[model samples]
Target: MRLLGIVGWTFCAALLAACGGNGDKVNTPGPVTPGQSSASISSNTAVSSLSRSSNNSSLSSGAMVMTCASVEGAVFIDETCPNWQEPSVFEQQKVNSNIYYEVPFGSDGALVSQKIIDSGDALYKKVWDIQYNNNNDFNGLPHFRAAAAFPAGVDMSAYATGKLIFDIKVLASPEANPDFTVHIECGWPCYSTDVRIPIDELNTWKTYELSVADLIRDGLKITNVAMGFQIIPRWGQQTNTHFQIDNIRWVKGSAPVTTKKCFAQHFDRTDWSYTTKVETVDQMPLDSSKWLAGVGPLVTLIPQWNSVGAAWGFSVRDTETLSSCAAKGTLSVSVLLPSAYVDDGQMQLGFYFISRSGLYYILDGIPASRLKADEWNTISTTIPAGKISNAEYMGVYFDSKGSNVANGYILLDNFVITHSLVQ
Candidate 1:
């Protein structure tokens, strides 16, 4: 299993007999994306669409091409700058072949596989074209792999601000083989980061953006990167499959992510953790605080929290430990106020989760000045889940909206959520 502190190894193809006939050496490749970093790493990450031969080789043989200096978040790096090259020899070699060189991919070109004639063909300028079948699976590995290791000194801190990018499109469908899966793997400190996304979007030049923060949350570190960058395929058993991959980069933008909804929390003394914040002792007139349950006789006062004054903000306890309730959901509460309370003050509520670690509450409604007065109003609004993929919890802020109050209080009870996926 891929977990913290565990690692995996992949070797280079050893014998020429393992290769599918040597196609003629091809052309140079270009790169892409953008980001921000503290280290001296290049911030220009942009991909220029270069014209290519049918196989993806550059139209002009031996002519230099332009690519992203880096995709951590920056726009574009100047490839024309002679000083721009792989930082060390470690980043310039094949995994098993210690040739101390960048393996040329595509028809013959790009990245750690700069220009050495290796396994795949260059479909176009700065892109690697791999046409693989089960017979060509190197050393009987699970799938088709195109990988290049970056030397030890390369810092991936910039990824925190952006995403990992893969510019690719499939030329064949699962009809080539039913169980097709594309695995993007990176070796980070303490563990290997592998994301398995199903090969579903077929035969289109689609750009996939993966969040860098999400990887770190899964136990990857930005400090130590000891693995080669690779995109491999698995379970493509037959029916020749063709694909063009280029602009493998760390970028500033993010690809759209899918969401699964089903979570909720009810604010009850038995279900909540903030029991100490409220009290059971009533300060009102004798029997005034008694509950009048519709179907029951009468009930005494119970532990509860009451908010007094303006700008009162309270959240569920330990939401930090739960999955982010980010983008969408609902927050509802039973609210009661003074008889003279007006509808001038507004209420705000929402969800927020950043980097899969911190929990933040967004502004659901501040200009919302429609809270009913005196009687208990079940106030609720939709939660934005897109703001946080894994939403942890939610909160509501009762703002006076600049209206001065005279010893007023907002009584809240039975706060809860609906369709919340978090436990």
Candidate 2:
């Protein structure tokens, strides 16, 4: 199949390395208490006048509180304090105390429109109203990030036993539902795994909590935390969507329990069918299906560099409807690279997927150094729950990077699709 020109190879390489790749290990933080001080709050009078209650808090004047909770032992991040008429403390970068900024990782022509919604007649006073539009350009995977920084690197050791809490409501979304990720960043390359917001819980104001210990376990440094909190949209969220966020804070307690189960489904050799497309180069026609083969447990893919800088790969699809396996799924396969290609390092192999929406999902770069020459290396990529639920045709695609080495062939086997479900 012809790979869409959505993302450039260099940009994809950097994104893969920063998102989940391994990096230099740092010293782990020492033991921490549950309620020790970790963050600094601005001297805003409005924030200091709020009264804490057992379940929620309200202004001393008895004004209603729209947040899920504002109890004792809680550190406020951004409560939308001082009303909406005043200037916002949040910015596009970290400059002072009680301030946050966006990562500015080119949004692929996505336009972000913002406004302060004054809900005087509702439970809350005001909130942030943000809308995202892709502007019809899907050449790159756009990223929407709002990162809050801690001045002088606060000691968040106390919250290690608690959870990061925030309130969100989705007002609009595309046909394919999309979720956002929460991150705790210490510095460059030091970040937590993408803690996704539940796709099923949207359209209404709801409180979402993430365990701080889980963030630490995923390489987050709570001791000398530079950026305390962040919210980012996951990949394949290209269409228009509208959402609202409020009452960001860190509270001392564990998250509420829920009943969600996840499992995996392995695809046998018979489950996959080979597919290819015809190409014309220099007035000569070439068909890749004639060169590719699928036998027993191994599927061989030979790249055809029809012209200079040309890119193509072999594909196999299974028309099985995996709508039930929603939440999040990971597709994995075993690839054995030829010794010649591994030694030359002129070409790179990467994994891509075709979502039910016909959107192409590409994984991080698979450098030669990461692959075992002449040995099987497991390659995988994650599919969002929205795409997984609407999926009718599932498949695995192998794309080559450069056009230098066109002779070496790759061996693929062991196709599997794993996902979690809310039972």
Candidate 3:
């Protein structure tokens, strides 16, 4: 599938220049559109275009600014930049072999394999040149590469949440490979898996988008994602095909609010741990005077959590037990946690609080799974005002229990305190 394409519109220069309102200096990309050519296309194509649009007179307050940075070779890092040792000595040697690192792309001269050299004559170089111009698969052989270790540390057991986004296009030429392939692989010292994508085909440019959410849904993690591409076969395993690639961008993507927020930042997991770290939560004492819910234990705090149908509810019985319900409320509390807990793939933890309700609801469900075991995870809860009318304390509980006893304990450290008025 052509993963991502223009949502509905293009950032034409005239349109962009018209976006600026009241002289808010906006930035834009250069004059070249998808298929257009530039005078100094080699050394300054991307940079020059970005520079020209730096002072875009037309910018809208509501429109998001899509900035372009050099998309060369690079890897994602975390907020807590921990000391990282390369996962393998081979990684060091392989990287050293490349003339230049091209990121989602690949090392320089990566396209030059023995086959191209063997062809030697002009016909061979023509084929090689055509492969680079028309092929979608660039940087196929020396696939995905990463820093020695994750930004925080190397805990292959822990899940890492990451994201990537970039624009891709096809170059015009007589000699070009219409069909191309790019595959992302998790490499060395870690389990291997690949997601291959066909980028350029028959003269077209498009954007490719992928997220950690996909991994969570598939029970995977960000750390397992690596960059690489597949060379389309010319004939029966010949293994000598080529492609061109540019504008590759990869980064950690945040979860969207459209879905149930299930298994996202709170309890998203990879491996056995519930991983999507809640790096931040809004928590504080609730205005116990009032609480409301759609029905049953699913309570809400009136106008406080005004975004009806937007927030989640969890009834806490005690530290390790919970009653879960989907609720809408007015006054409520949210707690932001550190990234460690969100992306770590934790499976269990406990919250402590007292409630006024006779049956203090212990409402808890992972953001993704019904109840996953061993994997790292995260969870969030909203206590309506009236729900805690009589009780004084309460907490969200975490645990890892299943067919196996080895994954029975959970750990938690970051805490947040904040609340909203009973809406």
Q: Regarding TM-score, does 1 or 3 come out ahead?
A: 1
lDDT values, one for every candidate = 0.32, 0.42, 0.25
- C-alpha RMSD of each candidate structure in angstroms: 23.9, 21.1, 21.9
Per-residue lDDT of candidate 3, residues 26-145 (tens digit): 111122111111110011111000001111111211122222232222221111012222111111122344543332322233333311122232211211121322223233243323
Off by over 4 Å in 1: 1-66, 70-125, 134-153, 173-193, 235-239, 253-423
Q: Is candidate 1 or candidate 2 better by lDDT?
A: 2
Tens digit per residue, CA lDDT, model 1, 137-177 = 22111111112333342345544435555555567643643
TM-score of the candidate numbered 3?
0.27
What's the true lDDT of residue 271 in model 3?
A: 24
Question: 229, model 2: CA deviation in Å?
Answer: 2.6
lDDT of 2 by residue, 3-43 (tens): 33222221111111111111112111122111111111111
Candidate 1 Cα lDDT to native = 0.32
Report the poorest 10 consecutive residues by lDDT, candidate 1: 14-23
Query: Residue-pair clashes per candidate, as listed?
Result: 52, 2, 98
Give the local distance difference test score of model 3: 0.25
Model 2 off-target regions past 4 Å? 1-110, 136-152, 254-423
